[model samples]
Each structure stands twice: as structure tokens, then as C-alpha cells.
Target: MADVMDIVIVASAFGMDAVRAQGHLKCAQASRRAGAAGFEVRRELFAGEAEAAPQRLRALGCAIAELGLWSVFSTPAALYTADGRLDAAALRLAFDEASALGARFVKLQLGGFVRDAAGAEIAEQTQDSNVRLVVENGQLAEGGSLTQFVGLFDALAREEHAHVLGMTFDIGNWAWRDVAPLEAAAQLAPHVEYIHCKTTMGEGARRFSAAPAADDTRFIAVLDRLPRDVPRGIEFPLDATRVEADAAHYVEWLAAV
Candidate 1:
């Protein structure tokens, strides 16, 4: 909602070793120094269960707020289970964690969501939740299929439950499922509330996230198609050795582009 594009630095972008050793509190400080509008706190990046406890998260949230930065809580949990049943436990935990962090959004994967009769169940579960719930396309075919997304949105729309959930469009993740990023963007742009900006490198099983080249037209094209007002997360790897140095530059570059 801020006039300036919100540049979010995913904790993992700082690399696992640094995040694990220094903890997400340090990473939040780096994100603020790098001029990021928001910091995405990853569930798996927490040093241990103690660091992820409610009390720790509340303290972390207070610290982050003092830095004048917003937060997005990303959990690897899925909204639905493999059997197309809602994973109430995962969803509840995600919401509770996000609330504790005072995050603006809570991101999850759209797992095994083959269909939904109506969104009443999901809407009820998410009712009164202050944090926005967003589903990201997974890196695997089971949850990343373009067809599944189209169907899911269509169904949500019919039931007027679209407001209950938003999309986290991860450009690089499409490569893992062999889907064209542009094509997916064109169809899903209307529902996207966040963008995971990155270019995938390597091939097949070796594919990994990397920063986009300056003149990468594909990256430009994808951004053009999606809503410009949404937050863009730097999910690509940054220079861990140098810590926050490259993050600021990328933040500036991404905001301009």
C-alpha cells in the first residue's frame, strides 16, 4: 500500500549458513540497512525450535518494527494435504506464527489442491486473521501445475472466496515444473499479491536460484505482466560473504526495473 515498491529480502537469500549462525534477528537488521521495505522470515531458517517459539517471535517482531520494516512470514507448510483435504494444523500454525511476528502476510504452498467445492471452509479458517494468507506455486509438479492454479482461482472466484487467499508468484519455481513463467503470469497476475523475483540457473535436477542478468528481457516481461503495486521478494541468492552489500544494490535495481 506504500507508494514505493516494497522490496522484501527473503532470509535465505543471505544463505543458510549465515542465517543459521547469526539468526533471523541479524538478518532483519541487514534487510533494513539494505533499504528493504520488508523482510521475509522463513520457518526453516530459524536456528532452532527455541528461536521459533512464540515469545522469541514476539521479541523479534518488536525489534523489526523498531527498524521501520514490515515482515512477511513464509512457511513451507501447505494449505491442503495430498488427499485434497485442508491441512488445518499447518494452516493454523502458519497463522499463529505470522500473527506472533506481526507479519503482513503469511505465505504457504498450494499442495495437492486438485479442487475445492467452495472456499467456505478456507474462508472460515482464515476469518478474523489479520495477516494475509498467500499461496505460492511449489517447485514440484504436484503443486506447481499451471492447470491446477487456473482451476483453483476459477473456483475461488465462483464462490467469492478470492479475497481469502492471494498468490505468491515465484518466477524461478516455474522452471522446476517446466511451465513458462510469462504464460503463468498472464493468467495469474490478477490474483498475485507478491512476486518472488529470481532467475533459475543450472539444468534439470541441478536447477538453482540466481540473480537475473541486467538485460534479461524475460524477467522484464514477467514483471510487466504482473501487478506493479505488489511486493517483490528477492528470493535469489545474494553474496553471503559480503552480507548486506549486494542486497541494497539489488533492492535499488529491482525497484527501478
Candidate 2:
């Protein structure tokens, strides 16, 4: 049998719909008990828990797989202030925080990159960082299309920063932009360092749900297209009433895949 991949439980899943309270320490403890190999610390879920997040996760024996930040790096209007300059200070702080948290990867959105000053700054700063920088195929506005992501990654590769920069392939995010998951996976798999595994239910404005069983052909097909060595994280809604059981089931299901 092949070795099981590392399964990480993203904190945001548990806190969905405000069902579970937001507490990084509590989330870490639950994740460790639920058989998750690691925990992803989301910036939105951190709230005021940022300062001591690393220490808290350490005490709970939960490995920090990635630090997820929500920042738009495309246009100066989104990343800069009134003075029309790149917010290098803010960007540095985000990277610094990820480093302090002991996370191996810092995940962000690929804002805008062709001749964009912010993108240039990101490549320059990431070259010197200890943590790997991963840009994800977020919802439409961030980076939802295969063409968009490929262009960005190809651009970075030419700059020689691809070694330090990687891709976080979100399996279900393709649906949000009408892109086929398999096609996106095929194009981005080589550059992937992390995977966000989630499936959606319903047609319009679908609800994010856990991965199907390993035997499910759709699930297996997508898994086969991704890099097995990369850490795959569960980024879905959790049943607050049965959070532990739900998490454990997800881990087992993904392991089988």
C-alpha cells in the first residue's frame, strides 16, 4: 500500500456558519485528536489569536502546515494606500508572521502580475524567505482560471522565483469560475505544493462539503491528477455537533484516496 498523504484540517471549516467558536488552541487540540496530520492556520479565523498562535499550536502537538492570508496583490488600488505605492511594510509583516508561526507554507492569492509592481515586490521579497510562498486559485476575483494561474506561475518561473514560490491547488474552486477541475489540475500539478480538497453540493452558489469516499470515481480521478506528495487539506464546512467524528472521517477518506 502507498503511504498515506498528510491530511490537514483547515480551521475555517470548523468555524463555518459561526457554529463552532473561533479559538486556534481549541481547533488545534480537536484536529490532533481527530487524526489530522496537521492544522492550517487561517488569518481570517485567527482574529486576535495571531500573536501566540504558534506557541498555542505547539502545546497542542499540532503541526502547522500553512499560514493562509487573504491579500490582493494585483492592482495598487487593492494592495496600496492613497499615496499609490506598494504596501511593502504590510507585506513584510505578513511574511514575518508566517515565519514566526513555524508554517512551512504561506498561502496567498495571485492578484495581478504582468508588469504589476506588487507582483514584482512579492517575487523579490519571497526569494529571501525561509517559508515557501504559495498562490492559490481562489474565488473568481483572486485566481480562478487555469489560464490566469498558468500565466502567473509561468511569469514567476522566468524570474527564477518559482523555486521558492509554489501553487496551492484548490480542487473545488474551479467550479466557482466555471473551470474544469481535472483540466486545472493537469496544468498546475507540477507547481503545486499544497492542495485544498473540497467538493460542492447544489448548483448555484453551492455549499462546500467534504471529499467523497476514496472509491468515488470523481474523487479518485481528481486525486490522481494532483501531486500525491503535497499536503492535502480539508477546506469544507463541519458539523459542529460532530466535529471530531467528521474530521476523523475526512482524514480516513482522504487517506484511502
Per-residue accuracy of model 1 over 157-236 as CA lDDT, tens digit each: 88888777999999989999989999999999999999999989999988999999999999989998999999999999
lDDT of 1 at 36: 97
Give the local distance difference test score of model 2: 0.65
Clash tally, candidates in order: 0, 1
Query: Global lDDT of each model?
Result: 0.90, 0.65
* Superposed model 2: Cα runs more than 4 Å off: 17-22, 49-90, 115-123, 206-210, 213-215
Give every collision pair in model 1.
none
Clashing residue pairs, candidate 2? 74-112
Q: Residues 10-33, candidate 2, lDDT per residue (tens digit)?
A: 877787434235456567667777
